[model samples]
Target: MTTSYPAQFLAVAGTRPEVIKLAPVLMAFAERSAEAKAALGVTGQHRNLIDAALNLFGLTPAFDLNLMRPGQSPAEFMGRALVDLTTILQHHQPRPAALIVQGDTTTATAAAWTGFLSRLPVAHVEAGLRTRDRRQPFPEEINRRTIGLLADWHFAPTPRARDHLLAEGVASERVLVVGNTVVDALRWLQQRLTEADLPASARRVLDAGYRLVLVTAHRREAFGTPLRNVLLALRDLVMSFENVRILFPVHPNPAVQEATREHLAGVEQIQCVEPLNYRQFIAAMSRADLIVTDSGGVQEEASSLGVPTLVTRDQTERPEGVEVGLVRLVGTERRRIVAEAAALLGDSTRQTRPDRPLNLYGDGQAGRRIVAALLGDANPPPPFVPSIIPTNSSDECRYESTQDRCGFQWSGPRHSRH
Candidate 1:
């Protein structure tokens, strides 16, 4: 039996979070490169931040559409990306058999919509995530739900997300509750870092008794005032603590740059450096004392690493960490953020603690589960928690292991007669 199509699949990711989560899926697809071709497309919605995550993951986008270079308003970026995506969907010689997209970002929404209109079936990873309160998370809550309307296969991270789609009238057969692939990513990075050993320069930086805080923030909602508040609080934290270094990876958005510099400049202890690659970012995460960000992915990553995270946003789509006491929400409140951060300066949850269980997401094999479901595999699958991927609500946190990963398995191959 021969597999056909462009011999590769296309994955569309625009932000750092999307790139981070999608890496596992892309790697899974890459694992099958002997039989399939996988190409990545960037909408440039995330630009610099995305590039860092991609480099860390050691993945590359086949096409880069500089959608956000000049810095467009939400309306402008969305409209432009949509038009660009439609063009990509219309062209691309020997089109991919499936398009892989993760989570809800402007880029994912546009790509999915374009794929749908092109009559190209989409396999949406991290599908069916919802906040219920649309305006609270703004376009994200809507972006994901909207993409679900047209997606052919939903690779949900939990039963809750799957149920969300079912409630919205998506067919049960089309929704598969695959655990999140992030744990796999985290585990992979953890192993790689442990094995390779850090370089002298980076290791020296880590060894200097400097407590590192990994910080990231880039959201349309947090553009002006909210951005300033968070940045100021971070700057204050650096000034207040000794040997406390803040590794703030600056996002490429002009607004983010201007706001970060305006608030973070002259703060000697804070290193607002260029975005590091995915592997490099993970190294930073691994080396961090505490993680601070407005990113949903960071919440999940920090949780898996057992690091305490202060989410700068008002709400989050991944609340699993908060449920387990691994993540806290400080929003963009300056004084509140500074106070909370100061408290965590000397303490952090140790990943080596024997008591922590890894369940809120799944064992690292989510990618496997997705492939299995697509091929109609039946295994003793873990029952997915039907709660939303918590960004800040504290609840139940069940941890699992990579050894426990049976996240995906295939019953049989589907061979089409060409």
Candidate 2:
């Protein structure tokens, strides 16, 4: 079952967030030909949404297991992914030395389990996320936890995330704070984008004098009545403010699309359109005065761009942004959502940047550091380390001397900047 070239490492991504975050990792592989060989495997869990981001980043997977079926249940889809992914790997000659997955998608979870069962090392990017209450996010919270236990390397986006892994007794040598890849992807997209590249519909909204408010809500927990309540808040906000306009890119799911159209279609100053591609979404975020979302990746992107954000969930796994005042968790209650949106909208003084830089996330070199770790090349510390001191846990981090490179060891509590 050998191929022309053995894929030294395989990156698995099925949804938009996974693809966006993994893009920089693939780029790291492409840039450093002298390092280990790498390839991508797409599960196509989000077939329609995955390609646009992949095309934007010039990425193509070696295997595309078109595993999604119409109206497929999570169990069905994951079972299919497991079977198809296993088949693909079986046929892949010289099998990948390691399998890398991102976030807490079903695809990532399935791939991690497959890798671990196959006796292959699994590296989890954006690892150690937790809401503790598994039902709040419906499977995502559990997915990351399962992967955290199964993974060989845990690339945490922040020290908080790193501490969670250490508290759970994962090997300190295997865990390292490598920042988040979403920041890397956002920075990369922001660099090449100009106004001319924005979608025509988005451009029209921007050209209008109304202050823009971006809204995106598609979490499973927020469906049904919670979703209706969120739309109700949007309606109230639209009716309350004459000068403000909202742009919401409706999710393609029938339940979501039906409810969105039913509640807010043809509403004044609110453009409820189909979902935007990553670039167009970025453009929309750029033009926005405020952002309301329940997405984990959006929290990271909005915080990195310094946009005021409101999370529509009761709890969030990504709270670094909230700590820095870049985000507020307002839940799905109508009055609370409307009140918070109104308060932030009226306050011009709150628009000023934070007094200090929020390095709570990372500086944008996570992809490189992840690669460096994967290849065991002790380079330097990640581009930016947060000011927070590492906590000494009962299971404090300790590094193996044999695995140390460039004299780098994270086992010690003392921070050393390379």
- Global lDDT of each candidate: 0.72, 0.82
CA RMSD for every model? Answer: 8.9, 7.1
Of the candidates shown, which would achieve the greatest TM-score relative to the real structure? 2
* C-alpha-based local distance difference test score of model 2: 0.82
Error of 2 at 50 (Å): 0.4
| Model 2 lDDT, residue 37, Cα | 76
Task: Please write out the lDDT profile of model 1 over residues 139-180, one tens digit for every residue.
Answer: 788888888887999988865566667778999978877778
> What is model 1's C-alpha RMSD?
8.9
Clashing pairs in 2: none
Taking all chains together, each candidate's TM-score versus the true structure is 0.80, 0.90
Candidate 2: tens digits of C-alpha lDDT, residues 290-320: 9999888888887766678999999988876
Error of 1 at 294 (Å): 0.7
Model 2 spans with C-alpha error above 4 angstroms: 1-5, 353-358, 382-384, 387-418
Model 2 Cα RMSD, 1 decimal: 7.1
